[model samples]
Target: MTRPPLLEIQDLRTYFYSRAKEAFIRSVDGVSLAIAPGETLGVVGESGSGKSVTALSILGLVGGNPGVITGAVHFAGGNGASGPRNLLADLERYVSLTKHDGRIVAVAKDEPGWRAHVERALARVRGKQIAMIFQNPKSSLNPFVTVGQQISEAVRLHTGVTHASEAKERALGWLERVRMDSPRLRFDQYPDGLSGGMCQRAMIAMALASEPSLLIADEPTTGLDATIQSRIVALLAELKSEFGVTTLLITHDIRVVSRLADTVAVMYGATVMEHGPARDVLAPGVEPKHPYTSALLASLPSTQTNGRRHAVDGRLPVIRGEVVDTMNVPRGCRFHARCDRITDAIRARCMGEEPALATVAAGHRMRCHLHPGEARGG
Candidate 1:
C-alpha cells in the first residue's frame, strides 16, 4: 500500500513589495510541492531561483513591509507509531498531532492575519515538525558562543529540560551522535574554531537537537571541498535514517539530487519547471517536455560528452530591464520572459495568461499552458 505524504504545499505564492517596479519582487511566484513522510524531496535551481524561498514559504517565514504571501502548507504528521497509513483515513487527526519548529527564523511581510498563521505554523516546526540547516555555516553560527551552548538552547526550548547540566549532557551526546571527535571538548569550541566540515556538523546538530519531524537543508555543503561536502551529506543522511526524519534538500547539483532525493522539483526563476520521481525528472530520455529541464541536465559535466560541457543556449534572462516589482504581478506566465522551448502562441499565453500546474504522470507535474489537457486527465 502507498504511504500518505507528510506535507502538501498548494499554490504557494510569496511576493515582496519593492519600489523598483510597480509590483512586488515576485520572488516565489506560485509553486506547489509535496513531501511524503520519510521521503527526501530535492528542490534544485540556481541562486535566486526561489528554491530556498519555497522552503521558507512552507514554514510561513517570509516577512517585512511590502511582502505578500498566500498559500496553504498542510501537514499530515507521520503516524505516531511510525509505519504508514492512508492519509485520507483521518487527516484531521494526523494534523492535530503536528508540531512546528520554533527556532527557525522567518522574515514575514506585514499582511492581514499573517501573524496568527505564522505563529501557528512555526509552533509545529520549532521543536517538533521541522528544522533547517542553511547554506553558510560561517554566517549561520555565532562566532562568540561555543557550539554546545547553541545546541543546548535548542534542546531546552524543545524538550524543556529544566536543568542546565542535563541539557549539557544531551548537547554533548548530539555532538557525539554527529560523529564529532572528542565531542565533550568540541562542545567548548566556538563556531570560528571548528573546521568547515565540523561547523556544518555543529549546525546540523543544533538543527536536530529538537528532534524535529522534518529537516530542510539549504545547500548545507556550500563553500566546502567535495570530500567535506560528501561527509556533511552523509552525516545528514545518517541522522535522517536514524531518526526517521523527513528531509527536504535544496541544491542546484543534480548529482546531489540523485544521491539524496526520492522526488525532485526543478525550478527556474520563481516557478517549478518540472517535477517527478528523481530519475524520471532527471532523465535524458526523449520526449522530455520542458526545455529548461533538458538544458540543465545537458549542462552537467560528463566525460562521455567528450569533456565539452553543454551550455544551455542563451544567457539566463534577467527579469529584464530592471528588477521586477513584487507588489503587483504582470499577467501571464512568470517564466514567459525567459523560456526557450515556448511556441509563439505559448509565449503569448505565457505572457498574458498564467498557467496552473498540470500533471503529466502519476506523481509528476509541470506548470505550462501546453499541458491543460493532462491537468484534467490527472
Candidate 2:
C-alpha cells in the first residue's frame, strides 16, 4: 500500500533581498518535494542551487528581510489529535509585495508578527517532530557546552525525558550507538576537542537522540576528509536501516545519494529539474532525463560499464556554462542557457517558456522541453 508523505513542500518560495543588487535573490523558488515515512529523499544540486535554503524553510529558519514569502510545508507526522498541519499556516497575512514585470521588486513584511506566528505554528513541531543536523558541526554545536550536555538538553526537550540523569544516560547511549570512541570520555568533551568526523558523529547522535519523525541533514558529509566522508556515509546508512527515520538529505554528491536515497530530486537554478526513483534517475543512459540531470551524471569520475569500472576517456565532461544566477533568472527554462541537448525543433520552446514538471514515466518527472505535452504536475 502507498503511504502519504510525512512532509510535503508545495510551491515553496524563499527569497532574500540583496541591497547591493536591489533585487530579490530567489534562493528557493517554487520547490515542491515530499518524503514518505521511513524513506530517504536526497536533494542533489550544485552549491547555490537552494538545497539548504529549502531545508531551512521547512524548519522556519530562513532569516533576513522578506524571507519565505510563499509556501506550504504540510507535515503529517503530528500526534493523532491534529491529523496534519501546515507549518506555514496563515503566512499570507504577514507580508505584502510589490512586483514589476512579474518579479518581486519590493517587499513589506511585518517581521515581528511573522516571527511570532511562525513560532506559534512550529512551537511543538520543529525540534520534536522534525530535527536537523546542519552543516559544519563545529560551528553548529555549542563550544562552551559539553557534547553530552547539549545532547541531553535536546533529549529532554523533545523526548519527554525530564530527569537530567536519565537524559544524560540516554545521550551517552546515543554516543555509543553512533560508535564514538570512548563514549564516556567523549561525552564530557566540548565540540572543539573532537575531530571533524567525531564532531559529525556527535551531531548525528544528538539529532537522532530526539527520535524526530523527519530528519533534515544538510550537507552531512561536506568539509571532511574523503576517508571520513565514507565513514560518515556508512554510519548514516546503518542508522537509516536501524532507525528507519524519514530523512531529507541535501548534498551535492551523487555517490552519496546513490547509496542512501530511495528517491532523488535534482535541483538547479533554484528549482527541481528531475525527480524520481533513484535507480532510474541515476542510471547511466536513462531515457527521458532532463539535460541538467544528464550533465550532472556525466560529470562523475568513473562509472561501471558492463560490470567493470572504467575511467572516463580523456578529460571529464564539463557543463559548458556557469551555474545559473538566481538573482536574475532567465525567462525560459532556468537550465536552457546551459543545456546541451536543445534541438532546433525544441529550441524555441526551450528559450521562450519554462516547462512544467511533467510525468515522463511511472514515478518519474522531468522539467524540460524534450518531454513536451505530458501531464503538468509534480
Candidate 3:
C-alpha cells in the first residue's frame, strides 16, 4: 500500500493583526502544497516573500494575539507502528495549559482520561515527530547554555531519557555525525566560542537528534561563508539520504534550492507563483509559465544577454505603501506591477482578476491568467 504525503498544507493564510490600524498584514496568503515521504520541497522567494512565515505556520508557531493563522497543516507521520496519522485533526488535545485573561488555566476538558490523552499526544508528536532548523544559528542557540547541553536537553525532552550521561552521549554522537571536529571537546563549549559554520552544524545536530519524520530547514546556510554554505548543504543532502528524512527547505537563495530541492515552489508577494520539479523550473533554456518566476530567473547572475549578465528591471513592490504595513496587497496578480511580460491585451485581466494556481505542465503549478487550461506532461 502506498503511504500518504508526509505533510499537507491547504489554503494557509497567516495574517498579523494591528489593533491600532485595524488591519491584517497578510504574511502568508492562501498557500497550499505537499511534501511526500522522504521528498524535499524547496520554497524560494525574496526576503519578504513569506517563506519563513509559511514554515512557522506549519510548526504551529504562528499563533497568539499578534498573528491569526487560518488553514490546515496536516502532518501525517507518527512512530510508524500504526501507519500515518493526521496530527492536526484536533490539536486542542495538545493544549494541556492555556492562558486566559492573564491567568494560567489548566483545562482537561472535563472528559475521562483527557489529561492523559493530551500528554500522550503532545509527547508523541511535535518536536519529536517534526523538527525545525532555523536560520541564524547564533540566534537560535542560547548563548548561556553549552551546545552539548542544549542538544542533550532536546534529546532528553523528546526521547524521555532519564540519565544525563545517556543524553550527553547521544548529543556527542550527533555532533560527530554532523562532522564537527573533536565532538567531545566541542560538547561543553558555549555558542560564543564556535564559528558560524560550527554553530550551524550544532543546530543541525540538535534538530536531527530527535530523528523527526519531517525536517523544516529555514535558510540553513544563512550567515555563512560560501565554502561553509556549500558544505552545510552537502551535509544536509547526505544526512537526508542517510536517515531517510523528508525536508521542507525554506530559503531566499535560488542556488541553494536548485542544489538541494527536488521540487521547488517560487513565492512572491505572499503567495506561490510557480511550483514544479526543480530541474524543469530552474534548468537552462527552459521558460517558466509565470511571469514572476521568469523575472526571478532573469535576475539570477547566471542569466546572460549577449555575454552580459541579465538583471530584472524595476524595484520590488512595497505592499500597502508602508514599511510596517503589508496588509494592503494589490488586487489581482501581485506580480503584474513588476512583470516584464505583461501585454496590453491581458493587462485588464491581470489587474482585475485573481488567478487561481493552474497546472501548466505535469506536476507543475502556476498562478497566472495566461495559462488557464489543464497541464500536460513533457
Question: Considering TM-score, which of the candidate structures 1 and 3 is the better prediction for this target?
Answer: 3
Ranking by TM-score: 2, 3, 1
Put down candidate 3 lDDT per residue, 203-322, tens digits, no spaces. 999988988888899999988998999999999988977886899999988888888888899988788888888877876566665777666665666533433224336533322222
Off by over 4 Å in 1: 78-113, 283-288, 303-332, 336-338, 343-352, 369-378
**TM-scores for the candidates:** 0.78, 0.95, 0.83
lDDT of each: 0.70, 0.87, 0.76
Off by over 4 Å in 2: 99-102, 284-288, 306-313, 373-378
Task: Write the residue-wise lDDT of candidate 2 on 1-378 in tens digits.
Answer: 078889889989889887874888899989998888899999999989999999999888989588898889989996755666888988889978787877667778887899888888888887788989977888889999999999998899999899999999999999998999999999999999999999999999999898899999999999889999999999999999998999999999998998999999999999998888887788644542678887887777765442222235667778888999999898899999889899899888888898998777777878888876354332
lDDT by residue (1-378, candidate 1, tens digit) is 056667777656565645654435667766777888788999987777788888776665656443434556666653355543221222222122112342112334335455554565466454455788888787789999999999999888887786899999999989989998899888998888888888888888888888877888888888888999988878877776787678889998877786788899988767787888886676434444555666566656643343223445643323223222333345676566656667976677788876766777788887677767364554
- Indicate the TM-score of model 2: 0.95
Pick the winner on lDDT between candidates 2 and 3. 2
Candidate 3 clashes between residue pairs 3 or more apart in a chain or in different chains: none
Candidate 3 residue 121 Cα shift, in angstroms, is 6.8
